[model samples]
Target chain A: MNKSILTKREKEVFELIIENYTTTEIALKLKISEKTVRNHISNVMQKLGVKGRASAVVELLKLGELSI
Target chain B: MIKRRFIKKVLVTSAVLFAFLLMCLIPNNNVLEPTQQLEYVSSEVNKIPIYLLDSHNMLGRTNVAINSKEIDKQARELLEILIKEKGDNKLPSGFKAIIPSETVINSLTYKDGLIKVDFSSSLLDVSTENETKVIEAIVYTLTGIEGVNKIIIYVDGNILTKLPKSKINLPSTLDRSYGINRDYSITSYHDITSFNVYYLSKYNDVEYYVPVTKYVNDSRDKVEIIVEELKQGSYDNNLMSYLNYQTELEKVDYDKNEIALTFNEYIFSDADNREVLDEVISAISLSIADSYNVEEVVFNYKNEEIHKSVIKMLE
Candidate 1:
């Protein structure tokens, strides 16, 4: 998958999720609405065609879009 | 005769099909028109883009234009929004107030090209990492107004010669020369040349232009530096740049007070929306306009006119 295809905000949300931040924690840390945080997660998951947030993170890691 | 007529019909049909195919192949420039009103609505109060620092420490500008008619009121309102502690009105994701939470602008005055901004003592309580960004947020936001060039910051009627927590000394008057995106990686500070470049960042699904002032030891012209920097994309990992990574500057020419940049086709490839394209143009124009005393910026692709924007500086 093309890495540059994901937006800056999506990358930020994905990184936070990978770091084990909950949706509420991500919302608080990024200073955005909880709905917006959920939107980002769903958007990323949709883009990667993953069913769950965990699968999305796994796909991103497998694609080398995220690293430990 | 019948066969000739039938051949003519077939030729005409194929010609029409070829023409339709060609039309589909041509790139549509009209698709990039502004479809959404660029407004930041928070708490029933319409907030325009005031420059603010992101979590990764990059300056993101708002897409909304400055309300020139009521400069003072808008400035004060934006300042209030900037300093307000956690409120129902939320900032875009990954961005936060540069000014500390408890800080308040007690008074703001514009006189003789200088904006005397008096802030409450709470402004001094910023941490060390935020010391410069806080000062930048104030100066940049204030000087963005018409007729304001320099800023004199004060804490309760006293000039802030040094930051309260970090103790970083301040120049008596601060302006754009104070620079954004100050690179601490440089070893030889004197040889550094500063250039202001704009990158795109999205908040609440609306793309905003983020201006980053880069200091490099290279001595290239400011316009070339900007185009190159823009092509290199945002230094901040979390910030998105609208310019495609493959975009290449074909040529740069300065004539009759106008700076023109010719770039490759990749510049338009990533812009899926007209508003985004317009922001890309403004971001490039504003960055160049802020750094150079130029009247206009002309963007060209393949030696053909793509777009031209008049440089309207805040002051």
Candidate 2:
């Protein structure tokens, strides 16, 4: 089915993260509220079973889920 | 008319006899004789993980066959296999024992998760380049056995506190914390964090995992560091990572004794088939199992759980 772990918005939020983007920058770049960006990160973390944003980024990279 | 009929009958009889003889002369390819058939006999041979140096001189984990069930016997047997001269024939292709040839195991004693083994002075005869790797192979391989968590080495009855050639300091007691195939990238000794991460390497066509203990100055989460280091791939040409450079970690959520990872579709070798490569899975799972105290790892794509790796199974 070509299923993906993150939605378009969620992936966008993480792509910015790899570029060393902060919550505000990601929110601004994606045109989403800061709260929404945080939520997206939180949702991805919850799905990944990891506790932190950095860990999530690391896991995603290992899984080939996100690109630098 | 009677003579003619008799002659035809004789010819028919002779033809039937010749056909029977030809059939008997031809070998029956389908039926195997009892002696020629293979006998199926089950043995107690077990495949146990043994750490050894590969062709690239990297400490790699591979399995060796042993039939012993007793822990003491198994420990000694594994040690024998780690000695190059003794166990070269026991190893699979592409692996070489790390223990120096002709080094004798003076004595081995195990109790309460600790193993104390004394080796002959010849153990120190390893080249400067392989000094640390020799110790690493011993520590990792011995500790890999269940119920044996630590080891102490003695050369000719004195604790091996230092390497003669490399001059690297050694602790009196050793465990996995001693680290195998280490990579030191720390700027300073202060605030140093050490964690184990696994990378992929191949010998011939067979793929195996190599654990690297990395010392870095960053005090961030160990898992975070592991993923980042893994993403950078391995600096050593012998080692590699299957992680796509573009892959990003979307989120990490931890439950009791388990860590789950959310990733983009790049994690899958076949995204359409929703398949993750075994090499990829082993590289991540082995690294996590070594660094994190988690018993299980759940891999997710979006919200759907794609794969689950039990930590014990990877070992």
Candidate 3:
């Protein structure tokens, strides 16, 4: 049940993360504030329902949206 | 794939995609690039030696090279591919893969539960992070692939002479050595992928994950590797190690014409702090001038009783 819905902005964050981008860099790259970047990551994590950064990565990978 | 897949349809629409699809439907053994060159493709034929491939002409669509050069050519191609994959001639585009551009992959093999990867000494670099990153990148890359569990790295195809952090109990195999470093920049290390292996770095005697945050600003640069358990009753061994460590790290910052001499608490252990202080002075005596040519070496385990011999050498 793919209840997890990611906004286009959240999708951008997810893509950058799998490629090893830090929140600070993601903020700089997207021209957003660090707080907003962190918020998006937090919101994405809440939607995906994962606990840790690594866990969110694993779950997103499980959904096949990101590939190593 | 996302961008390329879409771009291929619109921009390349002028390139006869319908004709290409028809050709593909015809079951011909080739896919034309945008240049429209009919480059033949064959998976089975690629495995055959080139000499045999050259010897025959499409006699009922049979490949022709039938001689010794085929094997040699194929082997050469394999080497070229591996070299390119190494990306040392350039670099792994985004991440900090600390191994040098010229470093050669001497041998890469996998068997049983281990992947034994050997590289040239060029792989050796300065900074604790570089050593850790190269180790992590190589190990994870191999282990991430199917059928690999452990990795042992070799320099110039030989095991390291001295580990970055000298271990009390000798490692059981070549894989245990994390070769010596000579430089100080932390960017020498590469970005680690998944799987956290908390390898302890013996900074003095206390075994712990040497956090490199003091050296790098990249939040993802947190690297750790597993060090084996101490055989001599873990607690005591840890104490003695940290004690020895404390003394070893004490240094004189000659840069500011200043010195930071920390007395190892353990130097007060078997011998009085005085004797340890004498050794510290003697070691620092080797050199501690503010010329900027010589880097300052810290002493974390010396005695307070400084010897004239040490001061004289600094002159």
**Predictions in order: chain A TM-score:** 0.87, 0.92, 0.83
Candidate 2 residues B89-123, lDDT tens each?
68889988878888999999989999999999999
**What DockQ, on C-alphas, does every prediction get?**
0.01, 0.01, 0.01
Listed for every candidate in order, the interface RMSD values in angstroms are 20.5, 15.4, 15.5
* Candidate 3 DockQ, CA atoms: 0.01
| lDDT by residue for model 2 (A2-60), tens | 24678988888888876667789888888889999989989999999988776676566
Q: Which ten residues in a row have the lowest lDDT in candidate 3 chain B?
A: B52-61
Mark the regions of model 3 whose C-alpha exceeds 4 Å error after superposition: A1-68, B1-93, B126-128, B161-315
Candidate of highest TM-score? 2
CA deviation > 4 Å runs, candidate 2: A1-68, B1-42, B188-191
Docking class of 2: incorrect
- lDDT score, candidate 3, position A42: 90
Candidate 1 residues lying further than 4 Å off, grouped into runs, are A1-68, B1-48, B55-57, B63-68, B86-95, B185-191, B255-257, B264-266, B270-276, B313-315
Candidate 3, residues A17-52: lDDT per residue as tens digits?
766688899899999998998898798779778766
Task: Supply every candidate's count of residue pairs whose N, Cα or C atoms clash at under 3 angstroms.
Answer: 1, 25, 32
lDDT of each: 0.69, 0.81, 0.40
